[model samples]
Target: MTPHNELRLLPWSGPDGKPCFLLSTDGPLSRLAGLTEAAQLDIAADLLEHAHEVLADESSAPEELRLVPSDLTGALGDALRVAASRGHRLPTPGTSDHGDSNEVPHLPAGAFG
Candidate 1:
């Protein structure tokens, strides 16, 4: 178990729809975290089929078209965060090294902003 002062990976997003990596000890993850993980996986799985459908339908609503990509991106982002933290390979097989520190470029702090 990680110490209380140490950072722990929470399986959810923060208030602003970003991954919520927070500090934790031996305490269990929040209910919201579990719900968010399940929801993200569900969205990811459904997007596989639904995205095709939306693309094939010419009459697809603008809202539907707009949301699918946004949601899919969010789902993929969450999955990437979890996988990166766990040092696990991504779902799709690729030549990229999932756990190679040398291969992965290290970004400076506050790079996102």
Candidate 2:
């Protein structure tokens, strides 16, 4: 179990559309949340690829183009939620647990280009 102040951010929202959280790190609910997060990431990846394809096609209809933004928006939301959840779980810098390795490795400029 984590400390009271260190609740794990859940991947899904509550009935009121507010964020949910996990207090303990074990049990069925935690496992379900992990699975849900993985599924959300997978869906977001697929949606991103599909969005690129749709945008790159010059002949795509206006209706098709319009739909892509809505889908992308949902995917982006899911991705941001996942990131926040995972980020909260990372060991803080200078902690003996993970040491000072919390810094993300720098990518070369234009690595994605």
Candidate 3:
């Protein structure tokens, strides 16, 4: 019987003991890396980038790589909502609820000054 590789991602850690994110492969992890391993490294690096953002937020957490869906929009939406609720406003996409500032106080990253 042939065994299939299961994708695994490890959170890269900063000096602070929090994971920044990095990609690692072992035994069964190679399959998800794909038919060629070259593409796998690129995907791994991207995962690390995403992990940085995930760690910044107190609400959302980085999940195991295989469990994550290809559709990231919905997952990002939830993260944005959580940030919004905490007074963090996303960059202006266009005219949107500008007048409803009272609904949720939006403080951009550097609004303190």
Point to the candidate with the largest lDDT: 2
lDDT of 1 at 9: 59
lDDT per residue, candidate 3, 7-89, as tens digits? 22222225885423223333444343223234434455575577666666667745533344443544454344333322322
* TM-scores for every predicted model: 0.48, 0.79, 0.24
Q: Model 3, stretches more than 4 Å misplaced?
A: 1-35, 61-113
Order of candidate numbers by lDDT, starting with the best: 2, 1, 3
lDDT of 2: 0.85
Q: lDDT tens digits, residues 55-103, model 2?
A: 8999999999999999989989989998998888875544434444556
* Clash pairs for candidate 3: 12-20, 12-21
Best by TM-score: 2
Q: Write the per-residue lDDT of candidate 1 for residues 5-49, one digit (tens) a residue.
A: 545456765799775665643345644555666776777788868
